[model samples]
Target: MTERKRVIQTGWNLENSYARLPKSFFNIIKPNPVSSPKLIILNYSLATSLGLNGQALQSNDGIAVLAGNQVPKGTLPLAQAYAGHQFGHFTMLGDGRAMLIGEQVMPSGERVDIQLKGSGKTPYSRGGDGRAALGPMLREYIISEAMHALGIGTTRSLAVVTTGEFVVRENQQLGAIMTRVAASHLRVGTFQYVSKWGTAMDLRALADYTLQRHFPAVDAGGNQYLFLLREVIKRQATLIAKWQLIGFIHGVMNTDNMAISGETIDYGPCAFMDTYDPETVFSSIDIHGRYAYGNQPHIAEWNLARFAETLLPLLHVNQDQAVKLAQEAISDFTKLYHYNWLTGMRAKLGIFNEEVQDEELIEGLLSLMQKYHSDYTNTFLSLTFDTRWDVALFGSTEFAHWYELWQERLGRQKEQKASSHQLMRSSNPALIPRNHQVEAALEAAVKQGDYSVMERLLDVLKDPYAHSTEQIDYATLPAISNRPYRTFCGT
Candidate 1:
């Protein structure tokens, strides 16, 4: 196919995803339209990666598709069916407000689900308006793109479109739709959705289909079921570790929000920590700190248990036998998550081999950071700089004491001693999407119709570890009055 053909919609062969499913699992429906549509942000890189036209995706035709203006040919826009345990409570939640517009098979032979979040309701809408507010839409667009740039596996925002209408949140806010592209929209909750109302045959069919589509190699070995769980565990471990290393708080860790692919999915009320606090909580809904910074690892384990419960019936014949197998598999989460987290943390601090005292050495630095309330991203970035002068940013005399231990620890490792430090410097970013910067970018867009700042922020974030004198200002944390930033649901 020629380059231009990539932008054209060819109707999907639904048999690949929908043909094998029982009708009770999903209610097929078209997307509901909003009042008016206007493009907010276009992720051309993500579009091009999926063998889509970068030019067309940024064009009116592409924006129309993203804004739910025109359902592309061969697409089936339906809100997926799934049930999730929200904040430890089981709730019958289905897409709620998001609608999936069929799937795309990429040049690399990967099938991706192209979904429009905030594209209005379905039978799953419950009692809501099926709309998304402008703030959260823009937030997902910025953060998801930023995460992708960081080399962490994450859903990409193909486009963000304003509905040119208002919705009631804390107050009236503009409505918008986010074109979210992902490996698959299948979540652990999807299994729960099917299992709750589906028969044994239906659940088995869903499991078999998932194995074929996402874990095909396992299917050939007659261990597809076990293999699928293993793969999901590894992905979630690595994904959660990446988030923690970068000081990202997912804010909500509901079972329904967990992606089977393990990429970071929902971006609601999510925020990066300006100051490293294990107890940091950003979501307005997380009033009791259920999904706090330090609690994520445990929460991920909890979610995996929910996933295990849904898969138990398919794992073994008897309930006790099934529970035994599920528990054995779920138990791997802690070691896997900590291994990934510790290894990444070691690299960030320039350590390699584990020492009996290394745990203290690492924990000591974090304690110092908490004592001084240091900027998590910046402190790590500064360590990768030429000299250790920037260590003062930690705001503690103890920081100097800790640096001595760090330097001594570095003496034991031989990977990059001097040169690898440069590599580490590059791997560690000097800038992130600061809460203030994102807010400023949105303010510029909403008030003045200017996206120049947003574009500029994306540019800086793309080369996060580089030292750009021109954009050095973007590297600094805002003053206290400017910080403790709070995000909203945006309806």
Candidate 2:
């Protein structure tokens, strides 16, 4: 017998709550129509979750919408304006190459931003062409989906539409647009924009709107802005901790890139660490390693402090009292980060109970990983699944000692061995988007029009916790390279 199909329309339930805000928040504009619109990839799962018609989005009309060639019926396309601290210098920046079409209200009544990246130039284009290259768009799709699968807080990609044109980066590269879905595109820089140039009322209005949208639980009265600051700090603390736990490096952690929603925002120049070195840096622009693997927490705190500064006018009536409260809230970052990181690391090592030695045990393994140049993901993975330590990295005497301590600590916990093992498995993914593999997949798709590589990568990435045979092909160590691997922003 044949089964009936579930037909869905291409209609997206879009609303423009952001557009209702004062005009300073965004510029009302439509995306620049692309030359040719082709829907190369569609995340059917994400599409369905957003109450969209997955197949209908692949239709001619849908492809046009996805490629920014045509605006959807319900969306109010606009470009956001904000300022950010690039590197360490403060500068004005915004969605120069992107437009937030509108917010999609889902079945659960949750609102999310639907933005088209690489759509075209905006008033805040900053003298550069507002376009995106195929490779970077594909990279964000891969890494962001992989992050979501790995249970990390991140901005997700719903589709990738090729623009049948070329964007000049280092060389001529095929242009593409990625549909980025986020809780909202609110950022620390968003607050800074209003605080620096906007009037006192402007700052309060943005804060009140943000508080209601992102943190409605924050009390309406009685220092709600300070509460908002605290909430953002807490979310960012845990978010950075999760990134560190997964050996993921954000690469560019500018204030603008720091999402107020606490999801990892931009994916430019980002890569997962193969080796466990805390000092690992991959972005070609990060000559100083400001956004290195280990520095994520510090950068998050710094960004939060900048965010706190913006809330000072709303934090308290007395300037001194406000400063004290913000400072106090900011100081909790170290403790919050350490607690969150250690809690995650404990699970990665199959430990169910906390002890004084727990932090030391984790640091010991990390130190050994750095000393032996061990692969970060695989090191924990070996303990989670593999019993044998035949590999030279774990064969060292130091690792052996650490192993004994770990085992002893595991025994001391109340949970059964099976429970501990299960936790470890759930905590540590068997696979990550390895840098070399990701580059190869990007090259095949962008240069040769071969998508099978990316398809397989995405397949294995979907079920990262399970011991699937297909994952083995992608889980192996990245090929040794002649020089340091570098990633570009592809701006």
Candidate 3:
């Protein structure tokens, strides 16, 4: 490529809508350049969706831009200011090492945030190195893509770039940066920041901007801020339900980590469950299991309650009436969450129609799985494909009775067996980002600098619902070890 061509950043189509907000909301800053930038992985599929030429993005200039060594034109990079209740402790926080470069307007006219994570420190570094490690960046890439393939709403990884520098953590780790794409970077914590520090006008402006950007469909005529809380509550209800259905433990559901867009935001200390244990805790710091596999729904409600608190002023002129409105919205969260979760569980079980006893039947199967330690993802896969698995567990007489009940439940529906099977196959993925497999892939890429394993893993994970033979190897469970699997907040 000619010097002139390389200098001209291609396919950016950027819009600085968020930067136009009040100065206190963000800091217009540029990324701290890295010495040498190398391409790790480029998401061509996602790139195409954003109207970017993947081939061009693989070029030297592209790698530089991704590594934060170069900023593309039309990009007014800014580090957003926000605060959060992390692990239930309120604190001030912001994009300490991340930058929201700009929004990319897709062919469909949808605007998405294109942020480079682990780029460098900003005004919110909090006296720490604003750098990221290769393992965590790749972890986010693998798991986020896996979540997308599994039909979950999540932030997408655009690319991962390795900076030829080391970051000091537990040990010296290779530093890297991740290109993340999201509907918007607005979070519940954004509201918290304005509510705590900014004036009521700032809070209202943030709420209005969030509604216009994300929940545009909501009627804005009356009590729109209240509607904003309701819309977010509903999205979060369904989002958490999806997370539960897939046995995903976010490990950290702090207010800052909860995106107002309802997309799964940070992948820190996040992992999928191998066994059917409700109290599974993977994050090393989550000793109390506040964000455990089963506690996600309640935690989501808690986060939404915090969000509702931020909107109390705008919800009504009277604090009492506002509290009532917020309480009503939060009260509906449990019903909405249960309804969404039950619907998802029914789909996973191949139940065409819900029955009054469906929850009982589902609970019975889960209890059996918990007692037998059946693999979560594969259990559903076995039910979907009629494949023999963990015969010792499936061969139990109690399981046989549950299977009979499930069959009877399915028979009640007018849908054919094939249609029911199809629903189950789609709802229950043939593969998930198994904890061991992800570790192996990350180990290979991080320590050995061999991305082939991760590449192969991503290839199969791209179509998690296919139930193809290629996924079997990826689907197999890891050997049981006495040591528990632990994930760290690789920030």
Candidate 4:
């Protein structure tokens, strides 16, 4: 018998749509190659979607390309320049430790950015070492993939590679690099960059380019910039509403981290809520709870406002008229966000129709969850199953009252009871990337060099809504000892 040998292809169909912009938009730079490149993981599913051969990508030659040791042919790499408002203060910042290697044009005609995060230092290093620890790199890989599975708009991870070196964080740790794929790296901060530093023409050119790339349906009629602003608001509204429905906290809501494409970018310090609390905050730097679970919608609108400011020059000829138009667009954010949030909340509660009392019922359940400190995901998941535990979970009388009201609401729906149950089941996930589980996975990987735990967690999270008796432990909440929890930015 003859053994089958694998064939490797080294060709990549790379494009540089972003590089076509003026030279001031970005700085061309090369990634600093690592000492010893080691493949941590390769997302075969994502690779296939990007029109790349997964088997070829895992080859020795491909691992070198992923680790910054070798650049793929026809790839033009550069670090993008953008300014952002960090914690309410504007500052000039860019791709400090990341580079856009190239754009992959999929077979379906969709284009996505291929970026190497934590690759090496560039002009935007900001006097810091351009490296990333293995733990945080793995965290982004796990959470970003989990987000995609949950049907949320987010940047996907293609591969993670170890640098076979050490990086200094709180202490020395193993260095790594993450390959991030996104619709585009354009951000609200990118607009702010041109608005603050570059000329008016630069801002207009960027707006036009962004429209052509992301929102092409919007014709360039009079006041096209204003139309662009409204479109961005709608995307951000829907994206943040999905986050809120799942009790996901973004942790860092800086303008730079908010992608103009409206997908969730930058997984630093992000965590899913365990107990139901509107004020839940896991990011250690969010001492003021500015970007807390409940504050996400408001923060999103604020970020969009900063984005709008960048387009003021193009919004209208007169400065005052531009401000008026921008204000009107910004004012629509709250209504759009509330509508999205309520729509998702209805689906989670198995309510298929609109009713004025729907908001009250949703708030009532949440208020009870907060009062009892009940598990958020579990409480919602339980709705799709037996109700015997509900009495004990939310207290006998309190849950009975809400349950009765909920049943009456369901009775009013035109859809059958079974259909509502299915809706609820699909909307509420049985498992999330729990903080304790994530920490445990990271610990095993960093301390014992074990990746099996992470692999198992990813397997369970891949089907978040499905209930499997054997994988039940992944749905459980963390012990009390893991309380008073906090997450860092991994800087």
Q: Which model scores highest in lDDT?
A: 3
Task: Give me the runs in candidate 3 sitting further than 4 Å from their true place.
Answer: 1-9
Global fold similarity of model 2 (TM-score): 0.97
**Deviation (Å) of 88 in candidate 3:** 0.8
lDDT of 1 by residue, 1-491 (tens): 53235345422222137533787777777757666688777776667667776666656666677777776665666767889888888878887788777777776768888888888877888998888887788788889888987888888888888988887876787888988888887888888888788888988898887877777667464546667777888889999999999899988888888999888998888888988899999888888999999999999988888888888888878889988888889899999998898888787877767777877887998887787777887778777774443445444678768887888888877766776586667667777889889989988876687889988988887767666775578877776784456776665
Clashing pairs in 2: none
RMSD of each: 2.8, 3.2, 1.4, 2.9
Give the clashing pairs for model 4: none
Clashing pairs counted in every model = 2, 0, 0, 0
TM-score attained by model 3? 0.98
Range of the 10 consecutive residues with the lowest summed lDDT in candidate 3:
1-10
lDDT of 2 by residue, 151-266 (tens): 99999999998998999988898999999999999999999999998999989889888988898876565778878888888899899999999999999999999999989989
lDDT of each: 0.79, 0.89, 0.91, 0.89
Best by TM-score: 3
Scored against the true structure, residue 330 in model 2 reaches a CA lDDT of: 100
lDDT of 4 by residue, 1-491 (tens): 11112212643567898898889999998769899989988998889888888877777778887888776666789999999989888999999999898998887899999899999898999998888999999999999999999999999999999999999999999999999999999999999999998998788889999999998888665567888899999999999999999989999999999998989999998999988899999999989999999999989999999999888889888999999999999999999999999999999989999999999999999988888888888898888774544455556588889989999999998999989999998998878999999999999998999999999999998988777774589987788774588999887
Candidate 3 per-residue lDDT, tens place, 408-478, comes to 88889999999999999889998999999999999999889899999999999999988889998998899
Q: Order candidates by lDDT, high to low.
A: 3, 4, 2, 1
Q: List the residue pairs that clash in candidate 1.
A: 11-74, 12-74
> Candidate 4: misplaced stretches above 4 Å?
1-8, 388-392
Residue 256 local lDDT, model 4: 97
Q: List TM-score per model, in order.
A: 0.93, 0.97, 0.98, 0.96
